[model samples]
Target: MSAFPIDYAAVFQALPGGVLLLTPQLVIADANEALLWRAGRERHELIGRPLFDVFPDNPDDPDASGMRNLRASLERVVATGVRDSMALQRYDVEAPGRPGTFEERYWSPVNTPVLDADGRVRLIVHRVEEVTEIVRAGAGDHPVDRVRMEAELYTRAQDLQEVNERLRLAQVREREVVLALQEAMLPAPVPVGHHRAAVRYRPAVGALNVCGDWYDLADLPGDRMAVAVGDVVGHGLAAACVMGQLRSALSAAARVADGPARALEVLGIYARSVDGAESTTAVQAVIDWSTHTLSYSSAGHPPPALLHPDGTVELLDGATDPPLGARPEHVDRPEAQVAFADDAVLVLYTDGLIERRLEDIDVGLARLAEALTRHRGADAETLADALLADLLPPGGATDDAALVIIRL
Candidate 1:
């Protein structure tokens, strides 16, 4: 024998508790039979109407807080896409026949969000259990005791709401502090002689708009400039502090070292001592305008791109090595140099610019090269923006990205 298919619509109507389907705007879309019976209202009166309009607060009661609490819970579900369980609430509904009379009601409500394919809240499932009879059961035998119990419940609900508000404020303050620290750590790029250069730093999206990515540009002695991009291994305030220290150490090393490889070697040594700095990746490059040479070294990072005037691209991956602090002992890092034409553009970036979830790194590199070749004719600033627009998603990347573009 074959089994029959399930009817979801019928099941929804047969649910034991009062259920309401609401839009993100709090409009009443549908109501189950149990809810219609409990609320003492017909389907036509409640459907196609705003939830608050249909069930407004009891105007005679100045202390009525049912509407406000329910609205807050629904709005929270829409904003964070998380479920909210409301405490016992005392609400009074209008009588079926009397126009101005109200009947006392108690409810326990839970609001849940239904997300679409793109992780956006599409609808809200508002389920409520009526407990009016339980609240009034001991009224005849012990009226004073019933009043005391109701008061205690109301006080507890108020305390919970206050605590939730405090937590939300604390989270906002923490995010603000992190953002300010990130801005202070990443300073503006220093002028690189007469070379046209542009740099862009974008943190990851969401509440914590900060991460462990950094970029540096400094003018070296003898008509040369050094540019570096690095990624620390974490997020939040701790990773940001570590990033600041490593970036400053590398900048100091680059000022005194003879070449890019020696500067990274110094950074690798420093990273081993700092907490939360292991497995960090960085690429340091120095461009000499006099000889038209680009010298670069990498510590487990993606290669830099060189776009020529003829729409040709070259990736500088010859000097790649393991990430910082990956080895048990110190090892000499490798360095490579390539000659570029005067009209060539040198691009150095963190891995977030091209990397995507579950995709091959080589595929991302190929995509970057293609984008660079197509925009070879643009200026340094324009080229930087174009590369980000082409490589990043419409909503932005999941990791931090630091980019440096220089016209040779």
Candidate 2:
């Protein structure tokens, strides 16, 4: 009715916690979605009603303090024009479909005064946090004995603290083991011929243990060499063990298989036979230095990016089959080939490098291409460092990422 329009319903409902608006006389004016759900009442039933009339204390119960405490807090907020917080109070709500009955509820409520331009109290914002679960969960065997309830809560808190400490120590030990496994497995001084090779690997931050990201380099019978980057399903000792097994199996298959495609096919078969290597994605490639040819195969993995000598970027994203161990039948690992000019860099990476929660993979892929174009003409190590810096600055990755760059 006033000249000023207040369309604050949408804004208040957008808040994460429960919010209620009360008039200067302590009458219910509006309530947000959170508070409506928490109170289990309709907007028509609460709005334009006096607060005490809607939620009066039980007359038969001598221990009813909800009305008294809430009234005292709201009075103080109105008098001093300051915020006041009430201790946890058991406020009962009218039972659904029942006329004059109530259900017990506990809430931690805070009352804040909203002042008008003239420094007069316009409205009161009542925010509540339900603490019934915490109270009921810690209730002791003797419900009437306050001393027993407090003692039980103290004992439970000590037990929880001890359990947390043990879990923390176990996580530390698992991380050390995963790190040692990675250090022992990942190739160092990567095997290279006429072209240069540089590798970078970063484990996910705040990981309880380790992840299943790995990279390997192996020499073939011809002047070509095999390189691979892969990720298993999960983290910790189980995934780390599976990664080691798959790496060894892929390396062995590369020696006997005809090309990169065949090598991945063989590796897929081996992974299916393993206990934990199922549902893994990998990119395997054989680069021939003499012919300057690259033959690569993918198994449900992100496509590789090729940075030409002239800074033109290409994504070798061809049709791919499902990940290993997806089906009993052998999935075809499709291979793609491209000839590279001198100083060309080909990067094979895991999804962690280019995937983020709630974002399209195309966005990340474009960023990767841009980074490659910007860092043209740099050597393998420099290019890799630059790409990692651009894509994953500090504390960026939520999953493990590995990169293998081959410069011809």
Candidate 3:
């Protein structure tokens, strides 16, 4: 399987128009030749540069509307993902020759957004056509004519802003519908044979859109209970629908397969057959109290934390395969076993529980182990609540968080 789901860099270069790829933070990650031609610079000079740093407003001029207008237009494009066309921009750039000098330039620029699989902006496509001649032509017009032109431009900008607001409001409503559908499909807390299990799910902050995080508990034959947690890549309605299908398939496979390992293998097959679940990460476990054994398998997922009765914490990092749909060949889903004693707790969770921006995943895992160790004696529900309250940010989480605890 390819390392990157999409080769956006290649796509950007192939396009005929000038293009710039920006990170979510608005830093330039790449630039195409058509864009470089306008700047009179090579790829290395501008590839990793910030947009404003590369072309700041000419400081010598008192009316440097370049920076002000450009910034406002780009902000609108990023926020709304709507294509924006400016009437005429007088943004100026540094002159190639004299040091500490500025050059005046006129341009008609258009900005558009490039979205990733999750419906989030991954890049911004900025295209410009030099309109210096056309703009200069208007210089001979009467003063009153110029004022009328300026008023028309202002009216058009207002119309675009109104349309953009409507688009954002509609998107919010659609997200709510998807969230309701996902919530309705989730199973309630239930008993699995002799074991009792509970799950907690929280949607990510901002619009409460549906995501692909899900957890399930199944009662298997002969005193066996199965638990699984998974996260699908991306968000919105398509991801939620794929998550629902995978959850049902995994539950059915757990009941028929010989063990957790075989069940994961079967699930991989089903995941590939489905249209949207190939990039999912998951962990599945079958706990048999009668045998006092816990068998589990991981598919490119964070290992489960096991809290022993004697205050020992163990992260079950066993032989694991790549995410479900990444491999086409037969995958060997090995099941690792550990002794399950009465009153011991096993915590299964999605990556959101331990993943944070700017923090290493190992650090997050260590924090979880510490939290579980501190609350080793509490009931499953109390422990879950404490973990969330302590770990999640006060402002709110940026991704969906789901965790399941099976107390034996």
Candidate 4:
């Protein structure tokens, strides 16, 4: 029998504790029933509103710090993609139907991040439990009892701080492991005969953005060389492992296959069996220095740029097809060849180098072609650095990019 479908929305509303779903911008996307009831608000009153605007600190209380602390905790979660357990807080909620009147409230709150496959925080789960009665009960009539309670609260806060530190350390260690794996997979590019080649791989900037962008270079017999760059669909360890498998498979196929197109066909067949390898985009090219020709093929990736001696740029886009594992049946991939001048340069790269949010891809391709023309006289290594500086933002790229430059 098939399993029953679960209604996630209903389960969210039925949760025992008050919960708010917030975007990274702190806008309230949703609030569970318990939260709406506790705040004395309707669903429409809170949804689509900025969190702080809906529950601002009471203006009458000069010492109020609830909003400030909560904002800090939420921001930390967004930055680190880690959970934050806040200390017990004294937050006053405005009394419903009574303007300018506020009631003293205490809360135990925790903010957790909902991370994407790339390890970036997509949403925040703000869970809170009202503890007004508990705090009031602990407030004794005698000064000695009150002092003891305050001491206990202080200890609890210290414990939470220690836990937060441990979590931060663990996150740091995980990032190190991912970076190490990426470095192990992508080795430095070596020269092919007299042709100088330079490669660059930049992971997306963020805690969880270490992705599966990769480049491989292999020297073939008869003064020929093959280079390929690919991007896996997701990010983190799973994507990296898939990237390693695909890169190795393509590299091996390049040695035995007759052309770039055939190498990609073999890689595509292997990708179908690998988990998390669907819709992977890659471009492979074989440069024959004796013939001064570059044969290339694409699996739904950005075209490689061929810069002529006179600075005229040619985009090798004539032989493009759907990404790997995109189709159920096997089909022969197309191949194209272009004769190059002795001093010409060839560039192969992933889309992150040129793609921007809400912009046309042609615009980015045009920009790249112009940059290549402007710096056509530079050596391969210098040209690679110049292109990255020109194309990437100062803060860094939003997606992983792998670039290969070869002087023909």
Please say which candidate is ahead in lDDT: 3 or 4: 4
Prediction 4 TM-score vs. true? 0.70
Q: What TM-score would every model get versus the actual structure?
A: 0.69, 0.68, 0.69, 0.70
Window of ten residues with lowest summed lDDT in model 1: 202-211
Candidate 4: RMSD to truth = 7.8
Best by TM-score: 4
Instruction: Write candidate 4's Cα lDDT for 302-363 as tens digits.
Output: 99999999999999999999999999999999999999988899999998899876678998
Clashes in model 1: which pairs? none
Ranking by lDDT: 4, 1, 2, 3
Question: What lDDT score is found at residue 238 in candidate 4?
Answer: 86
Residues 1-408 of candidate 2: C-alpha lDDT, one tens digit per residue? 769887766779877778889988989999888888887778898899999988788776676667876887787667546687665566777776786787766687889988652234679999999876777666645767645754554465445445645755777788888988887988795456544589988887543525899888887766888888899998888898899999888888888888878888998888877888889998888888789888888888898888998899988876366788887887566788888887788899998788866578999899999999998978888988898888873544657889998887
How does candidate 2 score on lDDT? Answer: 0.80
- Model 4, which residues run further than 4 Å from truth? 1-68, 74-89, 92-168
lDDT of 3 by residue, 1-408 (tens): 678798867776766666676665667788877777776667877777788888888777775666667676778666555567765666777766555677666777887877542335667777777765675567547888766755555466556656756866777887887788778877888776666786899877555345799998888888888999999888888888899998998989989998878888888988888888987998999888889989999888899989998878889887476889888688678789988788889999987778876677998899899898888889988998998887776656667889998777
Instruction: Write down the TM-score for model 1.
Output: 0.69
lDDT of every predicted structure (CA atoms): 0.88, 0.80, 0.79, 0.88
